[model samples]
Target: MDWMHEHELRRVNQIKLSLPSSGEEALAARERIQKRIAARRAARTPAAA
Candidate 1:
């Protein structure tokens, strides 16, 4: 179990290190995240104010 956790941590760190530093890749990722959040909000029912 401890070994699995260490392997996962290392994998996550490697993925983070490989991510885009700046420019279009980062911008696109940000935009996609924003759109996902907006979609989630739209899907939820609004409560009476």
Candidate 2:
């Protein structure tokens, strides 16, 4: 009955898909965050040649 429709299921599945569900996925997410932090830092300072 309810399983026939995908309204709520679709929303929940989207949330689940966005989460890091494994160690490798979690590591990748962490690396991405670190890269963002480094980029911000790099943007705020003068570079030396």
Largest lDDT belongs to which candidate? 2
Predict model 1's lDDT versus the native. 0.82
lDDT (CA) per prediction: 0.82, 0.83
Off by over 4 Å in 2: 1-21, 47-49
- State, as a TM-score between 0 and 1, how close model 1 is to the true structure: 0.46
lDDT of 1 by residue, 2-44 (tens): 6668879899889988887778688999999999999888777
Worst 10 residues of 1 by lDDT: 40-49
Each candidate structure's TM-score, on Cα atoms with residue i matched to residue i, is 0.46, 0.49
- Indicate the residue-level lDDT of 19 in model 2: 81
Give one digit per residue, the lDDT tens place, for model 2 in 3-37.
Answer: 64688888888998888679878899999999999
Worst 10 residues of 2 by lDDT: 40-49
